[model samples]
Target: MAKSPLFERGMVTRRAVLGDKHVDGATARKTDFDDDFQTLITEGAWGSVWSRPGLPRRERSLLTLALLAALGHEEEFAMHVRATANTGATAEDIKEALLHVAIYAGVPAANAAFRIAKQELAKLQEAAE
Candidate 1:
């Protein structure tokens, strides 16, 4: 089937935010079983929502991190934390977002997110050095 326009837009925005390496890896690992799932998020989340010009990528990054942490999605949270580099979100920004999560979402959730964020941030740091 031909790709939807939203999916196309999402692919471009997703690559811009997540980087080629990550997107390439994900595409490389795509299986028939998960292709539809990937497309759904690409179109719905990345294309339709992220493609909007109102919010800067930096704000979206922080919001994504908070939502992931609040929802206890450790893996995606870590991924978005890594995406901060491309989004212009600093470590300090992440810390503040997680602090809000601690208050609104509960401390335990934020605590786990903090651990994951630290690990991901360290990995990015090491790669830079």
Candidate 2:
């Protein structure tokens, strides 16, 4: 089947935020059973929503990080935290977003997110050195 325009657009956006290596790793591990699900995220989440022009990528990154933190989606939150480098979301922005998560989503969740974010940020910094 021909690839959808949304899928194509999503791949571009996804690679931009998540980086080529991360996206490639996921693609490389994709199985037949996950094909449909992967398409849905690429088209719906990355393409339809993230590709919208209304919000800046930085703002979107903050929102995504906050929501992931609130929901205690540790893994996804960590991934998005790393994505902030490309999304233009600074560490300060993440700190502020997690403060919101603390007030609304509870201290424990925000605390956990802070830990993950710190770890990811350290790894990123280490990579740069």
Top TM-score prediction, candidate number: 2
For each candidate in turn, give its C-alpha RMSD to the true structure in angstroms: 0.9, 0.6
Clashing residue pairs found in predicted model 2 = none
lDDT by residue for model 1 over 4-51, one digit each (tens)? 999999999999999999999999999999999999999999999999
Please give the lDDT score for candidate 2: 0.96
| Global local distance difference test of model 1 | 0.96
Give lDDT per model, in order.
0.96, 0.96
For residues 29-120, write the lDDT of model 2, one tens digit per residue.
Answer: 99999999999999999999999999999999999999999999999999999998899999999999999999998999999999999999
- Alpha-carbon runs more than 4 Å astray in model 2: none
What TM-score goes with each of the models?
A: 0.96, 0.98
| Alpha carbon deviation, residue 1, candidate 2 (Å) | 2.2
Off by over 4 Å in 1: none
